[model samples]
Target: MNATTQDIEQLGINTVRVLSADAVQKANSGHPGTPMGIAPIGHVLWAHTMNYNPKNPEWPNRDRFILSAGHACMLQYSYLYLTGYDISLDDIKNFRQLHSKAAGHPEYGLVDGVDVTTGPLGQGFANGVGFAIAQKHLAARYNKAGFNLFDYKIYAICSDGDIMEGVTAEAASLAGHLRLGNMIYFYDDNHISIEGDTSLAFDEDVAKRFEAYGWHVQTVADGNDLKALTEAVKNAKEETERPSLIKVRTHIGFGSPNKVDKASAHGSPLGADEVKLVKKNFGFDPEQSFVVPDEVLNYYRGKGDEGVRLEQKWNELYQSYKEKYPELWTEYDLERTGKLPDGWKDKLPVFDPAEGKVATRKASGKVLNAIADSLPGLIGGSADLAPSTDTNLDKYTSFTKDDRSGRNFHFGIREHAMGAALNGIALTKGLIPYGATFLIFSEYMRPPIRLAAIMKVRPIFIYTHDSIGLGEDGTTHQPVEQLISLRSIPNLMVIRPADANETAQAWRVAIEHKDGPVAIVLTRQSIPVIDQSKFAKAIELEKGAYILSDSEKEPDIILIGTGSEVALLIDAQARLKEESIAARVISMPSWELFEKQDAAYKEKVFPKAMKKRLAVEAGSVLGWHKYVTDEGDTIGMTTFGESAPAEDLYKEFGFTTDNVVSRAKALINR
Candidate 1:
């Protein structure tokens, strides 16, 4: 408010703009326009609104900021550097350089202050919703009348590209329906994109759209008006019942003399001449690049240091809270540190083969219910497919607008949004979140699933009705290629458990898995649970591939299978033995996990000396050759399935025991 303070604020904002331009120019790649345009927004957030401790970026209750329009990540990097986060001035200089924390996009674990990895448009927006959901749930579960232990707000800066993406629509709808008041998004309405002006495609009133979604919407006519931006954020904070969107009309390439408001400024860096001009326009020396005035750096750092005192105050209150409610505090301490309760693994269900046939999806449901009480912070639901996917937590109530304490979530029929939101939830410390849909629909969620993999976040993606096993759903719903497709992602662990017992162990692996997302592919039709007494223990599921049943002799052939097909392999192996032929059966649930095993273990599972192999599965045979050597053959669906019964579909797709036996005989002869 004072003259000196106001000058420093303006100087800080300009420094952000200039620094962003320099970084992009240096990298020779990246979107520089939006950062230059939205520097004031960043200035306002750290200096005026957000409560975050740079000294401790892991502070549990600190407000979260997501750069949803992640192409403009230099904006976030500028703020992170200025605010005294672990990001250094040299880090800015090394933007987009190999191994630098300043990645082209804001990566979660790679960067100190970034809350989630965001690159695909609208993912960050949905992630913000997830962050809001986590905050609300944590607050409801832990906060007493005065403690307010988990009242952190979730903030994001989105752009025209993000607003135009369909994921934001689903996420915004869900956020509004849940009445997540902790969410505050700034829509950067620059009206420009890579192709051309947004009017070429998007020209609708964003405010009215958000209003229809039940969000409290406000518009600031200018991005540079710090007072108006601050006022809008203040108004958003006061509305404690609905999520808020403050549309800030920013200018693309705000300070660049020639490139302002042009599509040319959107993706590529402003040229060297334009960069100098931008500096000159912002009252900086045209010759200087990456320049940060001492006053500007000190101003932002001072704002960041305020968070230390705020956290200290919270720490004192937390100590009192501990004394007043020791039991709750114990839970809080455990949850915040992301530690599972002692002996939580013992609560997982162990299925009996005598329980008759059970669908893996149904088995997953039992596992979820069995473990729900033990892991208090685990929460999730389906994309309105809970009944079919069997992903509902049976022992817990649903998480709704009125009750945030419930563990179950109804993510609606929005797979993509649910996928994006799951990333947000997983990024939050102490919370393990899951989402479900049919494996066929997993294609709709590729963006989020792949993003989660790239970030190495562990969000359990439970997809039921894997392959053609769902029956009667026909070709449109049957997922012939889905299994192999999921396996293709680098860091994702794709598991298709064989039976009830294997399904239970798959959930075990899912819960314990870290640093990457897990895709639990399940069948809709019932299948025989492997008798653990006669076969290898289901606990071997962690090894990814194992000998479920073996021949007595140095066997003539090997049969490998996953999920429902594993049962067929078992039946085939028995038939082969009756014919005076020896056969070995291997259960391979996850290719990614198997690849992680040492060479000796891998060789033991699929010995190089015994090369004659046959594999069976009701999905695409894409990646099976790695295990089934060049001398082997695979019986897999190379075409779509029909609307027949699951039994008929299995026979039609060559997924029966007879088919597997025939394939093994042929492979042995070859």
Candidate 2:
């Protein structure tokens, strides 16, 4: 607050602005305005407010920072470089170039200090909500009365575009309802968008809107006022019953004389002459690009050193807590590393076909409940469709504002927010989260699903009502193309389990597969479980596509199916035998998993010599052609289904034993 200290702080803030502008100008393809405008908030939070050690970015209890407006990534890059993080000045110079750490957006794992991969507008905002939920849940489950081991705040800098996104609205509402006191978001109220000023479309009183959502809203008239920004954050932290949103008014381009308040500055570089003028306005050398005065560097590094000391204190506290609660500490450590306890899979229930047929969704519910007691890290719920999705953990209480220790979540009809929040929880490293909804609604939350795949995070998505079998609800509820569409996402494992045992194995795969997101598609109607005693073991599902049953010799024809359609294929196999035509039944549960198999294994499953093949699936037939040769045919729903009983719909849609037999015989004759 003194004159010399204030001068140094101002110098550091300007240094961030100049460096960010230089990176964008050098790249010639980046957003430079918001960084220039929001540099003061960045400097205040990273240098003085947030407790994070750059050297140990993954410290479990460290405060999380997300640049929700990730287009202006140079702002984050400059701060990372200045604060002694692994990001170098040369990396900033190479912004937006191939192989550079400073991508056009802030990618989580690509940079040492970036917490989440954020780009498409409001995703980072929702991700921050996930972080807050993780912190609250961990604090509730692990922290002792005197030991505040899991207490940490989540902060994000959002922009006009971020606020406009519907996902942010959903996440903000949930955060407020949960009373996530650890969340604090700063809105960069520059009033500019890609098209023009927000008045062209957006003109709501954002503060009042958040107040309606149960947030403690505050406004800082000037974005550049560090003291005011600091005080606003302090007050936000003190308010424990609600999340906080601070609207900081700012110019689109803070120092550029001509483009200061223009929409043009929102994305493009300021050009050479304008950049020099802007530097002159900030009392910096016009000739310098990516320059950091030694004093500025030292000042920020000092802050980083302070973070190290804070972490050391936490480490000492954690050691004491470990001694006091050894068993809890062991489980906590395992959760952090994403390691399931030994023999946890032994808890999964195995079903017998003679036990009577069961819907895959019902079987999934039983499997979830059976393993919930052993896998403490497994936690999630449906989008207000828990009973329908059969995703509720019945043994546990609901996760609410009053009790964060409960594992069951009531996501409440917000599929979009549920997807993004799951990503946030997965990113927190101590929990394995899942979200459930009907297969059709996956369309509503595809962005977060794609983001989860991109980030290579583990978040299980349980989508029931898997096909036309979810009948009587008409075409809107039935998912004809959802299976193929989900398969299209790279790194996403889309597993449509054939029956109860297969559903159990899918859950096992989801829990063990940590490289990316997994979707377990289940059925609403009961289908006869394959007799495991006579056919291949259900565990063969991990191979993706396995021969469920085969003839006495090399089959003259092959029958392939997934989900409930597999049962029809098996019945068709029996009927084909009456004509002395040999057939092999292949349960192709997951295309992504199948593609991972070696070429020799793939050839074994669908051999070239046995070109006569028929594929049966009650969904789009687009991707099934690869398994069936050019001489073969596919029996699937080419058109949307009509309202009827599930059995009537299947018979009407040609997803029956007779249809499968006819298709197989036709393929063989061709």
Q: Tell me the deviation in Å of residue 557 in model 1.
A: 0.9
lDDT digits (tens) for residues 1-670 of candidate 2: 6787778788998988888788889989888899999999999898878999988999998999999999989889988888889999999999999999999999978999999999999999998888888898898899997789988899999999999999989999999999988899999999999788899999999999999999999999999888899999999999988999999999888999988888889889889899998899999889988889898999899989888999999999999999999988999999898888999899999898898899999999999999998999889998999998898898898889999998999887889999999999999887999999999999989999999999999899999999888889998999999999999999999999999999999999889998899999999998887787886444578889998998987898999999998988888888989889889999999998899899999888888888888888999999888888688888988999999999999999898888788877777777
Task: Give the Å error, residue 262, model 1.
Answer: 1.2
Query: RMSD of candidate 2 to the true fold?
Result: 1.0
Mark the regions of model 1 whose C-alpha exceeds 4 Å error after superposition. 536-538
- In TM-score terms, candidate 1 sits at 0.99
Clashing pairs in 1: none
lDDT of 2 at 54: 88
Q: Compose the digit string of candidate 1's lDDT tens values, residues 1-670.
A: 8999999999988898898899999999999999989989998898999999999998988999999999999999998988899999998899999999999999988878998888889999998888999998888888998898889999999999999999999999999999999999999999999998999998898999999999999999999999999999999999999999999999999999999999999999899999999998989999988889999888888988999989999999899999998989998798777677888889877778887999999999998889888888789999999999888887778999999998889998899999998898898888999999999999999999999999999999999999887899799999999888889998999999999888888888888888699999999999998887986444599999998888888889888889998988888888999998998888999888888899999888788999999988889989888888789898998988999898888888788888788878877877
TM-score of each: 0.99, 0.99
Write down the TM-score for model 2. 0.99
- RMSD after CA superposition, every candidate: 1.1, 1.0
Report lDDT (Cα) of residue 516, candidate 2. Answer: 96
